[model samples]
Target: MRQIPTLAPLPARLPDSVPFVGPETLERQRGAPFAARLGANENGFGPSPRAIAAMQAEAGEVWKYGDPTNHDLRAAIAAHCGVTPAHVVVGEGIDTLLGLAVRLMVAQGDRVVSSEGGYPTFDFHVTGFGGELLRVPYRDDRQDPQALVARAVEIGARMVYLCNPDNPMGGWHPPEVIEAALAALPDDILLILDEAYAEFAPALPRIDPDDPRVLRMRTFSKAHGMAGARIGWAIGAPVMIRAFDRVRNHFGVNRIAQAGALAALADTAHLDRTVAQVAAARDRIAAIARDNGLTTLPSATNFVAVDCGGDGDFARAVLTALGDRGVFVRMPWVAPQNRCIRVSCGPAGALDAFAEALPHALAMARQGASGG
Candidate 1:
């Protein structure tokens, strides 16, 4: 008898599917454009003009591959962060850096720790590499450092993941609390702090780049509004940073992206201005939520998570209603947290659409729920 044509078995620990379906995919199904793009926690304010100019000028150089060493960007980022270039390793956004972090530390079946309802990208990486995931529940919308540390200890986890200014709920733990959490972590277990929103959040707790047990990952995607550029990096002890090179796509950071990121880093004034605007927009979203009788989670990042004061069903309905109304948005993937829909900080016009849509969407969701 001939063997089955299947040449290899899928990894048991890998998820059997793609977990996140983007708003664009939904828009495609609906056959229309969204009036307000408040979903995906993106900064619609866009990248700096300096970065754009740099990218445009460098466009002619696209014929050349990027410096595989990522020398110039690394140097620029290092100087800005006050770290030595040796302590930094750039990749195709923090998502890729995270995958490298996981590969460097985790063997198949090695348990990893992250907040429940935290960033999904990290979870995707964990599953992709066949690591066992253990999620710590959030404490009042903020990712609980205490619970995460306890779980890390109990599970003998190889890695502990966190997003400082978190996604979905958009809550943050003050820096002192995070320092306390770090002190509690077992030295052998590595902490991968996802700081993609660091550019937007108020300065709080900071992890030393040279910290032996921590890897701080930041991205150009968020505050830089350079999501398409796919530029991000990790800061850690020199040896730990070096490990990423072993698994990273050496020439993955493209030339335009490198030139663009360098310019973005240089344009700190634009970053500061963007952060301030995001803060105001966050306040605006909160006001809209309140006007509609919803509670908005406190967020240091460029988004808000508005609670409809109901179950996941109601929240999902709100999400669908919002989508149907041409106001794209998202909610947490699981219970309790899923009671809220997340909205990013877009321009004022988008908020106007949201302010108008919130009441209508809620009414529609409530009516649908009543019918059932």
Candidate 2:
């Protein structure tokens, strides 16, 4: 046999697993299409009509590479965020941008901090870069910012990651709390704030695009309903933003995605409608949980975490039963929080399917728990 080149020392030790398994992969494994897809926290309400029109219009132009500079989109984002283009860097998605950020700051064995069971993608990036990832536990279902900062300081961590209006738990801290966390953090420690669900949040902390200590990441995937488009941006001080150009995949963002995101940004009416629909869906999800004698955690995101009144295994059993019934939903991976199942907001019909399947799924899970 021909000899093959050995993998790099860092990558050779890492597991061959992705941060998340896509719903498509799950469907392939299950050998059936799900009747409802609410597990991914995707905006099932879909992208704005204007965005769709723009993408369709740009389809013929797929022959050309997207602007290597991402100039026009960055300009639009800068105007929207009240920052100059130099302070913004566009990338394939927050996931790619997270990887770039990690590469920029995390040296081998350097300490980085994030909440236990927080956004796993960030963790993946940190580990991939051979950085030492230190995790702080969530307090009261929200990321304990104080604990995160304290741990980072204690270890002299190079970076800290926090997700606002958090995922898989759907809790949020007030603006003051976030600002206080920023104030308490040392200037040397870079904070990576993943604001993927920012659009659905009721309130947000004011952004200082000139702040060197923080990088705020936002995505078109959630609120813009452009998950498939795979576009996002990060805002930081001009110096930090400029550094990304050295390592980022310059032509990675597709032309269609750029066109779609640009149009979506301009269509404020569509965004407002989607936000309203998400709020209504959140309330409906809570009602469904109540009807099943379970409870939902308060959410400022487009998803709700419903307490299954059991432990991780029980919630997992419920999740399996839901999957068996062609309803796709997810639960937290770690305990205490794992007692809840996460349901993404969608149109009425999808929620109806979930509402229809839940009671039976709970019955099956209970029966399995009883060893029947």
Candidate 3:
């Protein structure tokens, strides 16, 4: 096929890669649906009934574009967070906001730092904008902010990314630890603190709304069960927050999502119930892991990482076995971390499905062990 005249030659620098493989794609490839959909860290307990009712009530508004100012939602978020509306910027999701942040801050050949085998989405955005990566290995499975900052200073990095309650591993540092990390960064290096799981973490620290050196990211996807809503925002200094307006898609947040997030925010009782359910699910996951002679990693988020007591290959075998039998858990991508399989907190029925498949997966893992 001839290249189109209107399009320039594709950049040689960007490697072909996707940040994550969706569970739906796996179901398609396996020609079967997952009995237990616990791989993606989504809240399967579901969104609040109130949020759904609100979305339904607002369904007629779909014909109109979302408010360009996002007035009411922004105001409510500001009130909840104890910050002015100027300090908030909502987007399609943290993923989209991350892309905008990377594009705004990283110049060609600029340096970015994150934990090795950390959330790949941030790394993807960095490279998509021509920034070189400086990946520091995680310290004891938790992404170490101190190490990240040292590397950032070493490389004169333009940006650093972190997930408070990190993905895959589901580990986290308290807010004070985060405060210390903020204090450690050079003034010019921007820290994109992704707090997608903040709502589920019990040890979450309080931050003064006036903090200058950090941008605390939050999303409704986890505890609020709004993964489909695609509502995420950042809390930052007014000037920093305003910078997003220069590049963000102003009308990217849809009307249904807006109603859902606002109602979800107002339903704290439902949020508490969901958190309790997640805790119970985590306990069940731990129990299952222990029964199977697997080790479960400590988690502050809504997922657990069960050590398969072997290497990446063994864990992959276990994951495949589970998927074949209709369970859909996942594993980390790099060794050491990849030695375990990650499972999200789902409905009790889903947990039962995982419990049923795990022993068989373990047996398959052992059978394949010699091949490794």
Candidate 4:
């Protein structure tokens, strides 16, 4: 037998599960296409026409590698956020940037703090870097910032992750609450504020880009409708932004994504239209849930979490039933919150498909729960 090199101690010990299973993977397993793709919280509305044109123009130039510095996109993002380019670092997406941020700050056995059922990718990165993740459970479906800060201080944690207008359950904290959390966090503790859904948020915490204690992440995946493009940026102190150059994949962001994102950023009208459409779709989803005698949690993101009026097992059944009917949706992995299924905002036709299937899915789920 041929000899193979041994894996590193860190990777060797890590779990073999991915943070999220893509809808494409599920479709492949089912051997059928989903009629209503409303699971991933993606902006099915899509990017601006200008953005499409820009990517199309860049298509023929895929032979060249993207700019290692990501100069133009960084400058544009800085202007948009009213910060200097020195305070910005662009990357493939928030996920990759998060991994880099984890690698930059966390070492083996370092203590990190996050919500119990918060964004799993952050937890995934923390564990990959051999950090100890201390979770504080959600209070009333919202991420308890105070609890997170308290736990971080108690553990002498090196990092804290908080997702504003949180995922799996789209609830948000106003500016004051987030400001209080930041004020409470110790200066030595780094706060990785994942604001991936910031565009749809009502009000955001006023954190200065110069604040060394916090690194704010924003993505083009949601409102910008460019999840497939895989581009996002982080705002931090100049020193922190410069540090990413040490370990980041210089050419990881492809040329087409860069062009598309740049064009998308410039089309303010299109972004405004997308946000409006998402808000309307959220209302429609809530209405659909109500019509089926279910309720939905308040949402400030591109998705709504519809309460299944049952436990995690029941919610899982509903999700599976929806999948069976060619309606793709998802649910939280942990308890309490898992009682709800997440449905993303999409075109009217897609929502119609979902609205049509949901009642039947629920009926099937209820039958299964009763062992019928």
Number of clashes recorded per candidate: 1, 0, 1, 0
lDDT (10s digit) by residue, model 2, range 184-206: 89989999999999998889998
Model 2 global lDDT (CA atoms, 0 to 1) = 0.94
Ten-residue region with minimum lDDT total, candidate 1: 6-15
Candidate 3 lDDT over residue span 1-372, tens digit each? 988556323256577778888989998999988888999899999999999999998898899888877788889999988889988988888888889989889888899998898888888888888889889998898899888988998889999998889887988897789878777887898888888998888776676666656788888889999988898888988888888889988888988999999999999999999999999999999999999988899998999999999999999999999999999988899978999999999999999999999999999889888764
Model 1 lDDT, residue 333, Cα: 83
Overall lDDT per candidate, in order of appearance? 0.88, 0.94, 0.88, 0.95
What TM-score fits each model? 0.96, 0.99, 0.96, 0.99
Quick one: how many clashes does candidate 2 have? 0
The 10-residue segment of model 4 with minimum total lDDT is 2-11
Residues 110-216, candidate 4, lDDT per residue (tens digit)? 99999988898999999999999999999999899999999999989999999998997999999999999999988899999999999999999999889999999
lDDT winner between candidates 1 and 2: 2
